[model samples]
Target: MDKVLLKYAEYNEPHESCTNTDIVDILNKKHSAMKPAASGSSEDTEMMGD
Candidate 1:
């Protein structure tokens, strides 16, 4: 998702358009319907120092 936004901003010219908060809100709404990953996986445990 971050990559997508970076690429969009990189290729597109800057203008008086959406702000950072606007982009965050848009991404949040777009992804909010998706299910999150499961907890307690090995990667997650390692990241949490558990």
Candidate 2:
């Protein structure tokens, strides 16, 4: 999501604050280090068996 958001931001040019795209891009890119939810679920979890 962050990646998509950042892509949009870059496509639209710079801004004073990070746009939704930038925020989403950063979050998605940093997903691994971010905390898991209370249910301990994460995007990576779905791919574990692969």
Candidate 3:
């Protein structure tokens, strides 16, 4: 999870309106949606080798 999300979850811990699980679920969905494309350029792969 991201630091901002983690902080938000922590802040919500004392509130009755939101739960940690809810925050986690939202974070998961956000992360999946923000995932990078599977295909990488040749330059990207070459940099990985170094």
- In candidate 2 the C-alpha lDDT for residue 23 amounts to 91
Top-TM-score structure, candidate number: 3
Q: Could you say which candidate leads in lDDT?
A: 3
Count of residue pairs whose backbone atoms collide, per candidate: 0, 7, 0
Residue by residue across 1-50, what tens digits does model 2's lDDT show? 99877765765665576789999988987785655462366555766857
Cα lDDT tens digits for candidate 1, 1-50: 99878765855666678899999998997676443543336568888895
Better of 1 and 3 by lDDT: 3
TM match of model 3 to true structure: 0.40
Q: Which window of 10 residues has the lowest lDDT sum in candidate 1?
A: 33-42
Candidate with more favorable, higher lDDT: 1 or 2: 1
- What's the best-to-worst order under TM-score? 3, 1, 2
Candidate 3 stretches with Cα past 4 Å from truth are: 1-16, 36-50
Q: Estimated TM-score per prediction?
A: 0.35, 0.31, 0.40
Candidate lDDT scores, in order, read: 0.72, 0.70, 0.73
